[model samples]
Target: MATFSSVGVGTGGLDSAALIKKMVDLEREPLAKLETQKAIVTTKISAFGQMKSLVSALSDAASKLTSVTGWNAVSTNSSDSKYVSATAVGGTLPTTFSVAVQSLAKAQSTASAALMPLGAAVGAGTVRLEVGRWSGTPESFTPGAGKAPVDIEVSASDKLSDIASKINGSGAGVTASILSDASGERLLLRSKVTGEEAGFRLSVMEGGDTDIGSAANTDASGLSRLVNGSTVTQSAADAKATVNGIAVSSGTNSFANTVSGVTFTAVQVTASPVEISVAKDTSAVSSNIDAFVSAYNAINQLINEATKFDTTTGKGALLQGDSTTIALQSALRSAVQSVTTGSSVFQRLADVGITQQRGGDLAVDKTKLAKAMNDNMEELKNMFRSTEGGSAEGIAVKIKATTTSLLSGDGFFKSKDNSLQLALKRNEADRVRGEARVDAFEKRLNARYSALDTQMSKLTALNAYVAQQVTTWNKSSG
Candidate 1:
């Protein structure tokens, strides 16, 4: 065999770095395309989520509209016809209502006499008097003992009434009043509060002739007994006071009681305007029905958009013609049809002026609707507003239940959204993984190319060195 020179053997470089570089570059296109597709899916999913939230709110509002039974409202107006009046039975309860009530009373005890200043006494000489509670200064006055309290006054203007008033106002734990009955206007004194410990006591200074009741030398403790014999000793002015025939523990006072499931609040005087009414709010049912219809329409639109696909454009519908969409559409249509076998008022949709056109869409017949609203409003209300025990008693209930189910958690929209979200997440993960592979492959290819270029340059330099040496040897030998 002929000898093959090392130059020829080493001429063809063993490096495939350039080929690897070209392969890695070609691989990047598929990964980039996948990333773009994933981004598009993410945008579509986010939009669908927002739409789902709005639809859910509309559905909840519809359910509330359908279930309303009575209007609970308050009005401060005095002349408004809606005001509920108190019952005729002594205390106030709403008109057309009966309330069981028991009356109560408050009273005072242990106080037999009123504190009198010595100035009211009939003594020939003046005696100083002080009337005030403990821990306070007394208001001083002078009196002449044993006479009409008015005649014994230290001043021309002062009388029994004036002295009683001053003593009562002294914060001495008693109240004073004028009892102008058949017995004449007597200065009546009573305790401010109804308790044995709260009764008033007084001291008379420098006058042995004064007794509390005499007006003569009406001593500090002169009024020792009640004016009347109806005992437990109430002030004479409070003789008629009684609460449900239960004797007051002491003196007369207003009281409140909650008895026999009725609340009775007594005031010193009756002041609040009594109210009574017996009419239902008729517009509430109609408003509820209208709200339900609007919400149903909203959900219908959402379903239609989600499941429909464009045949000409080859694009999937937003929710595109899915089973959930079809079911919702059918259920809503049936509910609006208003089938009632027993009720003459709501036997069909046409009765209520709801018409289904040839395009499979509902249209409101305003003229017929107005007639139905005016003539058979009660029947219409019964058809949609009445429900019992969690079951659809009417068209309105059925529609509300179904709409709520579809929009709430674990419902059609939620279930589908979860699926789509999972799909999007997986797609993005795959795209990212593919990109990473592409990057690593490219880096390896470039490193190989650099190594190959360095090796080739060294080989070429060695070949030049051998050629130069050969030329020098031939020249010397010749």
Candidate 2:
């Protein structure tokens, strides 16, 4: 009655263990099918995630076209860019103007008397720098309004190089450096920006004992030399120019507000007036159109690939024959082709040179598009942009509406994804129950087979004993 590890060890080698194994495997067929279905659902859900992202991108591109402000970009042309260069933005009316550059703004620069000896101590004290305007031959400084002096303290052992480092790190609105020459190194100070207000003035806040001066703030000794002994190399001045025959002055060379919505930078004084023209920027319109087309094409390509089927290989894509995806493809194409009477200018995409091709992708006719934009820009703007007075929705508006629905709370993506998740849950539940049932079945088969082996073993022993007794009786009778 001893049990053997091998399943086919008893029952006259009937191999009941192998038979049980085959039956158990056959029972798992349904669960295997469930597993395959679960895999398919999972892959389809992942594919939809990709589709939703592309649709969102298309929506973003469409949203940009819905705004009227984005279309107000203008192309500004200057007759002489060498003298004047300009740019236009933000609802600037198309107009031509004349500009004459008389002078370019300059920054004030100053130098101190050379402190002889290469490594001479420049005296210890605080160097106070002020941003202001300077005038007169001897130089009288007026600090700019609301400006505060930035102080840089010096140590007794500090050389001109150390003091220069401290000044440069002080954020004093002026750059400082040591200029080495035959006499020695001198402190050079220059305004960081070109403007009358950017001019800088230096004075020592007398402190550490070294070279004391009669006039601590102005005398030519110690750090005071940076002020009293300094001479102006250049004077601060505003850019002098005239726009449309009216003279205008700017602290900097660039004038942004002289002309409404038009900014021009004076590069140099011109011999004659520079003519400036503001025109509609057709290139920006073209770029927006191209972006929309590209975004739409991306969605189209994704749908095509996701639902594609290969007949030769007997294989289909993850979302092959999906109704939701197919409907989306048709709806988008219909939106592009639909005509809306709300727009008074362009009723259809084709009117703006946007044509749908045979492969369901949009193509742009650049020459035709340019002509349409040049001929009637307002109408073109009305085509894609939403306006007041409640006209019919534009093409972009229509497409964006569709995308919003698909990505919304009760949208197709959410609904479809939720369904797939439920299917996965059901698949797991079925797998767990089916495995448990098969396991119990295998255990039952084992128990029954084990009992059969014990019975067969006992019968074999009885047969052997009976045969021996029969042989001994026959021999005795003989």
Candidate 3:
């Protein structure tokens, strides 16, 4: 009789489960290769996305330089900024002027006589508030037109704090507060706006039931003390100034449209006139040019690195053999190098101190650019933003248009990305099918091995029984 030990449920003593796994792995090798290829495509798509973003940034920078307003910005300077400050718009002709700030506008305020306590009750009354201008030595009051007076009613039981709250919530363009001194607490009121016309006059008439004072009393001891006559603390006044020695009056300190395309704001009164000058801001134009150059160079650098091939390492970038990236780089370079035919002095970017480097990046010559901007500003502006559209369009405009077309929905990069995404989907589907086949093969191998193991065990059992019976017969015969 012969006996066999179980080795992975196989009659031949082989590990069938391990062998089946090895076979399945061999069969799925192609699927693994597909996964690797999908990874490569995904990386290439990411590289293209980054390149598109750089190109878009460059386009935005170029678009800013395509307008005269973008380059012709101006700045105003005041010799004594403590007295006045000014701002100017683009294309404002350079000029110098003398300015003197005489006085700033003021708001009117009034306060009542000292009362006993903040919560003490005062006489009941209806106080009518009106916003108007005051003039003349005796101060003749005329109510403002188109502005209806606001009236607030007070009761005999209402405290000073309650009266203040009622006046504040009445929308009378006056704010009320309780002020305290060594004598006692008093109610103070102030106009919301500045200048003479913003002044407010209060007229109070006593109610039938009174608490602190007589109903007909018009003296300081009565509720009528909050009026403008004896309670006036500060008078309202308008701002006065002089520009180029000419007197100028304004209701407010901030003066817009004082000079053409200029705004002047008075800070403080000045004893002598301050010099305010508006000039052509060449530095601003230079800064814009530098920004454009930097943005263009950024895109150029990205394209260069993404498309380069290294012969020494036998390695290449993700976009090395990509036709779309090659075409994009060529188009961007051509747009930057194109010349404007209509411009007289400045026809190309090189004419205005922007020149291409050996590596396709743009370089700016600050001194040369400043000279060009000063000598031929109109021609310089036209070179970058020509209104006569077509092949004669400016370089900035051409570059902007090229980038816009490339980044559109059906653009080159988008189409390439879509194709890669489709390939990834196909790869995933193939992998899934391969995995299913492997699983089915593994199940079949396990079932066959288990049946064979049962048959081998039965044979061994029968052989052992037969050997025992033969031994017993041999002993009987002996």
Best by lDDT: 2
lDDT of each: 0.48, 0.83, 0.80
Top candidate by TM-score: 3
Assess candidate 1 and give its lDDT: 0.48
User: Arrange candidates by lDDT, highest first: which order?
Assistant: 2, 3, 1
Ranking by TM-score: 3, 2, 1
lDDT of 3 by residue, 152-268 (tens): 888878887888899899999899999877877788989998888899887777775343223454666446655423478898888889888888877788777677877888999
- After best superposition, candidate 3 residue 145: deviation in angstroms? 4.6
Return whichever of 1 and 2 wins on TM-score.
2
lDDT per residue for candidate 2 within 1-478, as digits (tens), equals: 1122454535466877668778888987998998899888888888889888988999888887887756887889999899999998857899999999999999888888888778888777888889998878877888999999897888878898998898889888888888998997888888888888788877775665444333645766666766776788987788999998899999999998899999999998999999999987778878888999999999898998988999999998877898888998998898788776656768898988899887689999888889888988877777776544234677778887888988999998899889989999999999999988888878877778887788778888898999999999999999
Instruction: Write the number of the candidate with greater lDDT, choosing between 2 and 3.
Output: 2
C-alpha root-mean-square deviation, candidate 3: 4.8
Candidate 3 similarity to native, TM-score: 0.85
Give the residue spans of candidate 3 off by over 4 A. Answer: 1-7, 11-13, 27-38, 121-128, 143-145, 151-158, 162-172, 204-225, 228-230, 412-437, 459-478
Candidate 2 lDDT score at position 475? 100
Residue pairs of candidate 2 with colliding backbone atoms: 342-392
Residue 9, candidate 3: how far off, in angstroms? 1.9
**How badly does each model clash, as a count of residue pairs?**
37, 1, 0
TM-score list, all predictions? 0.49, 0.82, 0.85
In candidate 1, which residue ranges exceed 4 Å CA deviation? 1-25, 68-280, 305-317, 321-342, 355-367, 386-392, 407-409, 466-478
In angstroms, what RMSD does candidate 1 have relative to the true structure? 16.7
